[model samples]
Target: MKYDDFMGEVQHRLELPDTGRAVRATRAVLQSLGERLQAGEAEDLAASLPMEVDYYLESADSGQRFDYDEFVGKVADRANVDRSDAAYYAKAVFGLVSELVSAGEIEQVRAQLPDDYEDLFALIDAEEVEE
Candidate 1:
C-alpha cells in the first residue's frame, strides 16, 4: 500500500473504542513527558528534544480524560513490568511522547524504536498507578 493508504489505515484503526482510548492514553503520557522535558529531564533519558515546544500541545488540546494511574498501569503491562518500574519508565516515555506528538519536533524522532523510543511509560505510571 502507498504511504497515504497506510496512514489511512492507521487513522481508521484509531477510531476503535479501544484504539481511541489507547491514543488518548498515549497522548496523556506524551503530554506529561513533554512537561518533564520542558523542566530539563529529557536529557536524563538521552533524548535530544526538539527546540520547538508546539508538538506537545496535544495534551492540552485533547479533551480525553484518563485516570493518571490507570493510564500508567496500561503502559506498565505493555512494558512487561510492575507498576513501580513502569512509573519510572513512564516519566521518561511520556516526556518524549509529549514532544514527538507535538507538531514541531515529532518527525525527527518518529522513527525511534517503540520499546526504547518511548519507554517513559514506566515513569509516568509510577506516581499514580491505578488499582
Candidate 2:
C-alpha cells in the first residue's frame, strides 16, 4: 500500500487521533520487527513495504535476540509511548502487515519469533478463523 493509505488505515484501525501518532506507531512496530528478523529476512520484508516504512527495517539492528516483552519495550522506547499503549500499537500495525504481506512471509516472521510473539499476531489468526 502507499504510505498515505497505509497510515490512514493504521490510524483508522487503531482509532488514533492523527497521522503523526499512526506514523510513530508504524515506525515503532516496523523497527521492532526488523530487529527481530534476520538481516536477509528483514531485507526481503522491506522490499514489500513502502519506502518510508521500509526505512525503519533497513535502519534496524538485526540479529538481536529478544523476547515478546523486550519487543514491546523496544517499541515503547522508539514510539515514545507507554508500554501498554505500545502493545496496542504494535498489534494494530502487525495486524495490518499480516493483511498486506504474503502469508509465507508472515509465516517466516512467525518462525523467527518466540511463541509469545503469537499474541501480537492474534488478529491474523482471528481473521483466518473467520475466513
lDDT of every model, 2 decimals:
0.40, 0.89
Q: How close is candidate 1 to the true structure, as a TM-score?
A: 0.29
lDDT of 2 by residue, 40-121 (tens): 8888878888899889887899878989999999999988999999998888898888777899998998888889998888
- The TM-scores, one per candidate, come to 0.29, 0.95
lDDT of candidate 1 over 1-131, digit per residue (tens): 33234223333433324444434433344454433332232332223333222244322333333344654665566545577755654554444344334433443232332334344344333433653
The residue-level lDDT of candidate 1 at 70 comes to 59
Q: Model 2, which residues run further than 4 Å from truth?
A: none
For candidate 2, give the lDDT of residue 3: 95
